[model samples]
Target chain A: MTLILDYEAGNLASVKRACKEVGLDAEFCADGDQLRHAERVIFPGVGAAGSAMRSLAHRGLDEALREVILRGVPVLGICLGLQVSLDHSEENDTPTLGLIPGRVRRFNLDRTDLKVPHMGWNEVVPCRPHPVLAGIDPGDEFYFVHAYYTDPKVADCVLARTEYEHSFASAVGYNSYIGTQFHPEKSGRVGLRLLANFAAWDGQC
Target chain B: MLSKRVIACLDVRDGRLAKSIKFVDTKDIGDPVEKARAYYLDGLDELVFYDITASSDRRSIMLDVVESVASQVFIPLSVGGGIRSVSDATDLRLAGAEKINVNSAAVQRPALIDECAAAIGNQNVVLSMDVRRVEPTQALPSGYEIVINGGRQPMQMDALAWALDGERRGAGELVVNSIDADGTKEGYEIALTALISSSVRIPVIASGGAGKPEHLHQVLTEGKADAALVASMVHYGEYRVSDLKEYLQRQGLKMRMSW
Candidate 1:
């Protein structure tokens, strides 16, 4: 069964609903043991990174998540879930799970034309092929709402890039771990297509 | 590039889609969930559900409506109307709303914005202001005043000042609804919208007074609004969301049409 990590930072109801819509039966799993044994894990949330890390650590889910990725279990991280998967985040100066070699930085745009948080729908151009982004086209846009963005260290780790103030890694993956800066659950049909792709993805690039 | 958003505002009253002219003389339109699904199918960028009455007793009804709509419709859903405390905002967020809009409550106690932003991130907090064009006083230099309680009470607050203040208090976006042109279909208040949009760095949604697609074009281009919120134009089935997106796209504006 597909499990969504519930660390109190995510909108679990919406994610569960989207999974059901995509014909994927999913349930909220807060137990680290349950998460480790799950066939697929969907990590999703919105909020500060420090608090999210704290909550995960408090529940011992941080180590459990790292273990899940290392075991080749399919893992998908969304929004803050994606941010906390990196090495560190500028938000709260918190250290995050080092599943991917990178750091999360806040959007420091000097242009008045672009707003921080990037709260709207924008295009996600796939830079490389990945299973989770199978049907996402060049023109397909996803819902994004975050002040900070993932900046992966290795060039090959960047799966997709979106332009706002500059081209940032909107989607990143390393080994069995896949993360997106946008919310697939909230992007309408194109977004649902992404969730369906994730449901079918077998942790293979 | 971030495309300009086209938002459909559903003024829900008694669990039904309702509409009013100048925030009075309300009329039932239809079921909100059905209309929301229809708009979602038509490739509407975002949806906003404003509980028009927002009385304390009817809070659960609004949540049920939001939950149903968010479960079926997968666009970014923003809910406003009766959010008085951080818990209220949290409840809606848990019920599947991506953003919580604070208007009268924020004006009553501005700290509610900061509190909600702290609980939920700053990105999920939206400040929706009901603005009326008034004589430019020394205190209200922008020539606009803020109204509260569904446009019934005047707050004597300057629109420009409130917009800036809302931004300072951690509001991620602003919904500037012109009380003068709410249901008039004359088009948005260009000067007022432009004033707030230019003054604040956060994205501003130009709301109220969208008669046709060209009005949206004007507001998005000349008025410099990041998004245009429509109620009457799309509510009465006069124009479909696809028609508006197609018209705006033809007029050289980027819109999200790939549903």
Candidate 2:
């Protein structure tokens, strides 16, 4: 069973609908106790960084999630949820729950050619093979709509990295904890396949 | 690298398409759902359904259409027309509208933008403005007073200022349609569109008066809008969506070609 953690964020309904479309017994888990029953958890978010972190903390989901992840259950974070795994962010001047040893920062490019919000489909080159990206190739594009990227200390944790003005960490994993910077739900077929592989991945925590 | 969006807008009145759309090999494309589904399969970027009947009582049926479209379609769907109150916007939201476009209602009650944006978050709320070019009349004091209710009522407001206020009110996007050049097929009102796009940071979509694929390109490169929203050109089988993308690619505009 896959439980999708529901915080105060956009795209919750879309994610739940995607899980159902993919034929997974997915339930919307609002609290930590409800999430404890699922075989895996999808911590997804869309919108500003600090507001999302505040909502997670306000619901006590942050502490509960920390406990849940420490229990060795598989947890996959998406978009802003993935950024929260980093150490800190320049947005809202707040620190994140450092699940991965890294700091989140904004895209430092000042080129007139590139837009501020990279609002489109962008592909990434896979660094290594994993069940999380089973059906997708290194060059397959995923939907992205943000201005920030994560800078992790250990390069081995990164599964795939995408390029803007410069390359950045697009996907990362440290043990049972995994996170993706792009929104697989928004991406078309390639994205659906990636979510399916993650849902059915053999790497048991 | 933002992908160029090809939107399919279905104007419904009495549960029928306001304008006819041509299908690839089908007989009579009367149903909005089927047309929308066909466009989605054809790799259209997005789909928008606007209820544009001057008079109609279709609260339940309209919502049913929205729900049915949302259930099958995966791309972003925007619905507009008669979105006056927060409750009306909520009805669409419950029916799975990814974005709500407001034109007349927004001008009448500018606060509605903020209210709706607050309820559903700003990214989903799009403030649509309809403006027509004035021929520089001496009697009229201001040039380009905002037109509302399909250009029936004109408000004493500037399009640029309204665009700025709309963005300030938490609108993630704007659809600036030119009433003057609409249906003329000459080209986009790039000057009018540029004014709005330059005023605010949010993505602006230029609508109305698209003659050919070059119009789309001109709007992108010249108007500097993030996107160009079209209805008649694509609806009347003037050009295919892929044709526009190919032309844009040939003209050196960055776009997602396949998928």
Number of the top candidate by DockQ? 1
DockQ of each: 0.81, 0.36
Q: Residue B256: error of model 1 in Å?
A: 1.0
- Candidate 2 contains a number of clashing pairs equal to 0
**Please, what is the whole-model Cα lDDT of each candidate in the order they appear?**
0.91, 0.76
Q: Which pairs of residues collide in candidate 2?
A: none
Candidate 2 lDDT over A1-205, as tens digits, reads: 7878788776676676666667756777778666666678888976677888888877777777777777777788898889887788877877998888888888878666565556556776688777787767755767776778888889888888888888888889887888888877767667677778777764453
* TM-score on alpha carbons, each prediction: 0.98, 0.87
* Model 2 segments more than 4 A misplaced: A107-109, A112-116, B20-29, B53-59, B136-143
Interface root-mean-square deviation of model 1 in angstroms is 1.1
Could you tell me the lDDT of residue B142 within candidate 2?
A: 31
Q: Quote the positional error of residue B212 for candidate 2 in Å.
A: 1.9
TM-score of chain B of each: 0.98, 0.90
User: Which ten residues in a row are the worst by lDDT in model 2 chain B?
Assistant: B20-29
Question: For residues B1-259, what per-residue lDDT tens digits would candidate 1 score against the true structure?
Answer: 8899999999899899999888888999899999999999999999999998656667899889999998899988999998899999988988889899999999999999999988887888999999999999998899999999989999889999999999999999999999998888999999999999999989999999999899999999889999999998998889999999999999988888799
Q: Write the per-residue lDDT of candidate 2 for residues B137-243, one digit (tens) a residue.
A: 54333355578876667676777778889999988788888877776778889988877777677787888778898888999888988877777777667777777
